[model samples]
Target: MRYLVDLGWLRSGLSFSFGEYFDPENTAFGVMRVCNDDLVAGGKGFGPHPHSDMEIVTVVLRGQVKHEDNLGNAEVTKEGQVQRMSAGSGIIHAEYNASESEELQFLQLWFMPRARGGAPSYETSSYEPSQMVNHLLPVVSHTGSEQVASINQDLTIYLSRLERGNELSFHQEAGRRVFLFVIEGELEVSGHVMETRDTARIQNEPHLQLAAKEDTKYMLIDLP
Candidate 1:
């Protein structure tokens, strides 16, 4: 992981190359391109930017995020909310903290679309924090349900909170990949211990066993 601090107001822990940070050896994982854990000071954020053929997802972890886009979409997403934007052909958007005195923490992820040159679109969905207790709540998926944001990719993003001593299991089809990120607290994934902000990239593992060492909140992505 790489740490990024921008202008004293934005701090980020990046899992893949983004912005001015580039690592040829660690560029991307499957179709997933960027995973940035960002903490922005109140009233600060990125200005309007352009993107094309990218599946962008944002999960607000604390405070609120104000999103504005050239597609005439403007909204505020609070904690537990998920936002997805498909920059199919092209799109321009900006994100900022909604509060003037509160810090905002969120995870911004980018994925390569299955095919490019479609119409751009945006959507938001939310789940109650209680719904994730010891359960993997699907927040984003290609086949989206009412409570899940749809994206132009063959992947599903799940959020979960596990209490100490609680365990969870996942099984995937053969030849698929798994990406795990610890958002808070600690967990023992398979056999490796992961603390806050640690990530695990797995392939050829059809089954995974996770146990919480402490009360933990995490995000897991099943990628093709």
Candidate 2:
């Protein structure tokens, strides 16, 4: 149901630079590929960059980031908001902290393109924190659920926050894989303790059970 990715395990080897956090794998997980949790210092940012055949979604947890693309799209997404960019065919974009003094923390997700070529598009929305309590709150989906914004891959992203002593379960499809990232507080997942920023990649299980040691925050990614 869920594998535990200890923060201590990943931070030991990973490095950071250019306002980027890299978590490369031999092969990205299913249709859902890259997941980078980044923290951008104020007044510093990422310049223009190129990407093609990928769906990039940015979810801010704190502070704000300004996004600008070659197609004349410019916007700023704050905490509680979701920004989706489809780099179909090809596109050049840049992201930086909008604030001059506050550090920005956010998650950048990349999904493999479902098809070869198409036009590019961008969409954004705000989600209330309460929506994630006791259950998964779909933030982005390939089919585009009502509250969840649309994307370009057959995957889903959900955010959940559980109060102290709360518990939750997640079920996986026959051949599906799941990734969980603990953002805050403590959790006992499958009997192991996971603290903030720890992640878990789980496969070969029908379901998972998570219990909150305190008010815990986390994300669940279901990849196709």
Candidate 3:
């Protein structure tokens, strides 16, 4: 199931119990606590906020994001960049649009860490747009073995940009969960047709298939 969240300058298609849209049965999926397709207004951004014991990931979809944290990392994440923040014990951070004239669009994901209470950390990585074309590129992973940023969780984040008619497949393990979030265009996952801002949650399934109905860009979360 999916939920639409349009908050004027800050819109999101939330995948879990987020903000005021709460659902006890839809609180979380596996280790994934939050999945939000966010679009922020230019010259406006989130103020400094505290977080603890959470692995946060920011996937830049368009424009750019500037991040400042108490850990002394003031970084800008551009389009196609992934920013990973591990608020082990605690961290205070602020996010804003890197460009005052352009809006910022991104996907912000939060996951429960395997263990908590350690020092906070931050890192970032980027990929070429063509790198994800027609294939799933591992942008974030737990083992630090993938060709992307490392995070403190047992999950993998895959990104793809498929042209119309392109096809792909994903295999899931028992008790694992998978989530599909469409960033642009359209795609068909199994028998479900998903458009922009739509998300599909999968579990207890063995095989997952995806086909591009139109030129589509999307994100997939493989969580335990």
Score every model by TM-score.
Answer: 0.97, 0.87, 0.94
Put down candidate 3 lDDT per residue, 86-149, tens digits, no spaces: 9999999999988888999888999999899978999988777798999989999987643598
Model 3 segments beyond 4 Å from truth? 1-8, 145-147
Q: How does model 1 score by TM-score?
A: 0.97
Stretches of candidate 1 off by over 4 Å are none
Worst 10 residues of 1 by lDDT: 1-10
* Candidate 2 or 1, higher TM-score: 1
Candidate 3 yields a Cα-based lDDT of: 0.89
Number of the top-ranking candidate, with lDDT as the measure: 1
- C-alpha local distance difference test of each model: 0.93, 0.79, 0.89
Ranking by lDDT: 1, 3, 2
Q: How many angstroms is residue 157 displaced in model 2 relative to the true structure, after the best TM-score fit?
A: 0.2
RMSD of 1: 1.0
